[model samples]
Target: MADYKSGDTASWDFEQVRRSQSNSPARRSQSGGSGRRTQDSQPPANRRRRKKRHFNVVTYILFVLVTSAILAGVGWLLINDLCAFNKEDITATIEVTADDTIGSIADKLHDAGLIEYKWFFRLFATVADAKDKIGTGTYELSTEMDYRALIVGMHNSSGNLNSDTVRVTIPEGYTVSQIIKLLAENGVNTEENLLEAAKTATFDYDYIDNNSEDISRLEGYLFPDTYDFYLNEKASSALNRLIKNFNSKLDEEKLAQAEARGYDLQDIITIASLIEKETDGTDQANIASVIYNRLEGPGDKGGTYGMLQIDASLLYALPDHTGPITNEDKQVDSKYNLYKYAGLPPTPIANPGLASIEAALDPADTNYYYYALGKDGKHHFSSTLAEHNAFLNSGDYAG
Candidate 1:
């Protein structure tokens, strides 16, 4: 009765009382299995000290950042002024070589008083993708040109309207003679000099096959594009500029893709030229597929007996000849006559545009081995000789 403690352990025996508390639920929860303490069970002074240390670290970081920002504001004003504004309205001559770097170009611009900071120019050139676009050329630049205009003015070929420049556009499928004639008429060079350069000048490009003794040796290599040439420019320089621009378009990715398809750049260009002349732009991919299917044939795989049978290839030899191909014309004894030859022509028939080149590389997935121009100004393709003959004889091609 004495140890009852109102039937609880609130009794007077100290040992009994301590033992009872040790077994209590609250005591067991705080002690856990080995009497380890949680963060909340730490001393108040120790917890406060840890919180004060964390606050000091954050405060120090903020203080340093604020001080640095204040100092950086003054530098920003100077950088902005130098990058965005300029002085002097004088003109400067900038010469960029083929192997020039952005750092070198920046140094030239700075020396010419066109830019105040070289680092800024380098940063801008990288960010704007002008690192590779700015090619070898001599540019007469005025100080009034902004950063963007300066980049454009220094490009190897462009339509930038300026003094000492004339814009000339070489269209797709134009022959070498036509290209030279067009450039001459535009006053870029004399026709006599251009012809001599075409005949004699040496181009160091690897893709130009120099074995051919044909007068128009650079027939298909001159890429078609709009260019702003200097008035009275040298014939070799103008031609080289065009050829270099063409070379730049054939990157490693495209070259690898051509190799994977078992064709070289020259072969792809030849096929593209045929496609360019075969049909209007509407059925380029389909015609490309048909050409591929036929070239793969002479059997169950390629059904056209390994002959291209293209009429346009024949016309390339006769400069003045025009009109549709006749049955008798197929007998012409020339390498350009695809009906008589089994493989690609000696060279490309004409310069092909990017669209034709793309179609040549990625032809549409199809079973077509024959195509004929319909009355609707589109090419109708067929997989079988019977279906192709039916389309030709039916003459109900209006649709």
Candidate 2:
């Protein structure tokens, strides 16, 4: 229906229009290809994220395993070594020398079967820093104690070597000779050595003056009391201890009391010995008064009244006198026999107690001249010789 020019025909050709319409479908296919490339990139990104999560899980598992292994190793070491140490059980005496080193003591412990392993003890000591802390002494170790306890015991210094010493109590009133005899009998000293110690030792000065012929002899001066000494003590040591005890017991007050009285120390001792020999009852002061009165009173026979006629003193004078006194023995003449001598005996006959000594110094006031024991163990006193003769003749004292 329209005439076309040459240029218009070139611009609107039918074949070219058909070709262009087909190219539109090809361009739409290229756009759809871009969406498929985007989907592939998304899959690659998700795979990287999953790989990172898997790596984190492995690292956490390894860390937990390593920590558990370390803890288990520590527990095993503690159970095997530190918790098993204990003392060995054995009966052995461990003598620790003075200022002994830790190594030496450890060796001794090992020798005594007290420790199973000496090195273990050393290790414990090292850990506790107790090398110098261990004491030096005798120790009685038991197997029942742990190693720690044994160490503690050594540090505490609890055991001694001389645990079984013999204790002897020298009672009050024992003479030096008697004490020496006791020492000999008890195996503490020899008789010869004891006698020599008593003689040469200063303890015997109380009995004999320095210038006198009698050098050393202790009679009543050895105070009697219990004494304790080691069985191995020397005789001289025993004597020294006895002297020390006497010095302690004899205070200044008692000495002053003796001096205040008119009697010298030895005289008071002599009277006390006489009083002890004559009486047994609590009325010793009364008996003491009788002896004092007689000393001050008139004599019995003549020539300054030489005879005291004490029956006990006569018995002392007899050489073989053992049993009761007979009437015949009283006639024996000896200086010790108060019946023969004028004053007190040469020395005290026995050790006298303080009470007897005090009684001798301060006798009760009485006028009686003679006294005889009755059948009832009581004394009958008289002022006149006729009364005394009658009382004796009555035979009421036939004890």
Q: Best candidate per lDDT, number?
A: 1
Q: What is the lDDT of residue 386 in candidate 1?
A: 84
Alpha-carbon TM-score of each model against the true structure: 0.60, 0.50
Model 1 poorest 10 in a row by lDDT: 155-164
What's the C-alpha lDDT at position 313 in model 1?
Answer: 89
List candidate 1 stretches off by more than 4 Å. 1-163, 210-215, 298-303, 397-399
Candidate lDDT values, in order:
0.78, 0.63
Candidate 2 regions off by >4 Å? Answer: 1-176, 204-216, 247-261, 300-306, 331-333, 378-380
Clashes of each: 1, 13
Q: Tell me the tens digit of each residue's lDDT in model 1 across 56-156.
A: 99999999999899879857744553444546776899887757888999999989988777887788888875753565677898767767788877764
lDDT tens digits, residue span 55-130, model 2? 9999999999999999898656443333433433476677766557677877987787666566767778888745
For candidate 2, the TM-score is: 0.50
